[model samples]
Target: MIQRSTRFGHLLRSFRDAPSSSSSKIGGYLLASTASSPLKQACVSTNRDDEFANLDWDNLGFGMVPTDYMYIMKCSKGESFEHGQLSNFGNIELSPASGVLNYGQGAYEGTKAYKKEDGRLLLFRPDQNAIRLKNSAERMCMPSPSIDQFVDALKQTVLANKRWVPPPGKGSLYIRPLIMGSGEILGLGAAPEYTFLIYVSPVGNYFKEGLAPLNLYVEEEFDRASRGGTGGVKSITNYAPGLKALTRAKNRGFSDVLYLDSTNKKNLEEVSSCNIFVVKGNAISTPATNGTILAGITRKSIIDIARDHGYQVEEGTITVDELIHADEVFCTGTAVGVAPVGSITYQGTRMEFKTGAQTVSQQLYFTLEAIKKGLIEDKKGWIVEIDQ
Candidate 1:
């Protein structure tokens, strides 16, 4: 069990031990709708039939395919999250003048659930995601669920859509949790209400190259995030602004954009979607999380794993000159997992790195994947098994 702050722990305990009338009402509504809807009927039939027999698990890409159900909860302003329910996966009704639409007052998280060979489902570091979401909600002035509530809701969502989970080695279930200011508000301020939702989709590799090395284009024109910004958090606003640069890079046959610090424009901040790491000789270093980079969970785990494997891991400033001359480079994230960097182009200078067999990235990738798939003992207790 994860520990919570005193005030939040007491509040969550009260909310859970004593159900409010509002929760009862929400639960009743979900039950009635799920029992009567045609979509729900189809979902039940599909769950009863063969699950993976219909899905082409090997060919799944990183795209959203509607699952059976999603978890939802709502809260009023200046209140704790009191209730939640699992409902059919569908479009949500939101006001046109919502804060998320107008002012981008929202945050989201990405994590995955893997199915073990023995028919056990496992989650990787969900508590970390819960903490990150709480911090993000605080930044956006939205009410967030407690750590227990958040993890419980995730387990509920995964269990409700267990049929959609891919096979042991084929793929995994991508879980996306979103929190947004949903109340009707036109002025530039926090909305009067908030919505918390969790949805899952079966997905294979995020990049088309699988574990192959990716070609990165150094982006000097636009910055992904500035100092004292929401770059450290998983805000939805931080993604759309990089599409133009991403499109330009993709057109030039690059896989992603590597951004530099906005102020200096010299040190490497991060990749557009993943955290970067460089290995030179026996030393492995990555950019520090200094309010301008998202502190990735996988990055942290790899750092620890590298240290355990007798590699010196340093978290500090990594210059482009050093990166271009490094022995190996790779990126880590929930979606990307661990992918080697084949080459980087900066100022019309293309630098290549060693990839493929017997590299540090390959070693780390296989170790992490084995631990996730239950092929090795989980000494760090990172895997949380969902009850059947």
Candidate 2:
């Protein structure tokens, strides 16, 4: 009974231990009309569903477009959480003194849901993203939201925003789960309170320019990860230092820059947002996730797909010269997935690759796509339904 003293705190704690048995399915969702909150500003809004249908599919871009609804929750120092409910998709309020602003303590994870041809909404590897977010919270000295609470909140949030996901083949709804310190203070200490927010946007292709083959600029001058750095973790701080080289590559008409291992620049690593891969005859290779590169879900999925298609997938230290001589190159992530690289421009020398259109790389891309779109047998049990 002592857990009842702090009200919502106990509720939050109990959420970690709740049973998730689907003894029976409930009826249609129960919608919220309005509620009161005193901790901070929190609200949800919805636009007309017709507004999304009116977009020109040919001109759509990446990132979440404004959607019909969103879910929000707030916590503060020495007070119960006043707003932890699903609502409309709208802007949220945060104080300038929030710990995330000054200490860079905020982190997020990205996952997607595809509405199947038969009308069931499927989440590809949502649990993977949930587990990764827990790692992020641990790295930042925050509590890990139990997988049950995380998944349950996601089920509630995604159901509330299911309409935002495009119909089959149109696109998907990108779900972002974020944790930030909400206790407004100027001290460099872990804030005892935090706010968890989940938002959804019906986004299409990641590259607005289209998923065409891209040219890569090999960057040995800048490093994206160190031996014991947050590079492996999806922390925001790992990005800023790599911006100079990434922007330089973009200025020269390249899609991305390859980051080399920090200790020695010879070891090939991943780009800003995607993990690297190479195809050589029948052998597929990617950098092993040795606490340096972000263990991309797509990268792992590609490995599985490759093995299933009778190819040898290898992961270890891949050098710059190895990539230059690679028969084919590709990168994978939630956003920039299975992006083919035609040539590698390292320093002043350009090495062109022969990525046979009918080769292993293209085949793996299609295989993964088929699984994501619900056209293939889900051997790994990766899909989870967000909407009933």
In angstroms, give how far residue 353 of model 2 lies from its true place: 1.8
Residue range 169-195, candidate 1, lDDT tens digits: 999999999999988899789999898
Which pairs clash in model 2? 44-88, 45-88, 45-89
- Alpha-carbon error at 90 in model 1, in Å? 0.3
Deviation (Å) of 68 in candidate 2: 2.2
Task: Evaluate model 1: give its lDDT.
Answer: 0.84
Against the reference, the lDDT scores of all candidates come to 0.84, 0.72
Model 2 regions more than 4 Å off? 1-53, 75-83
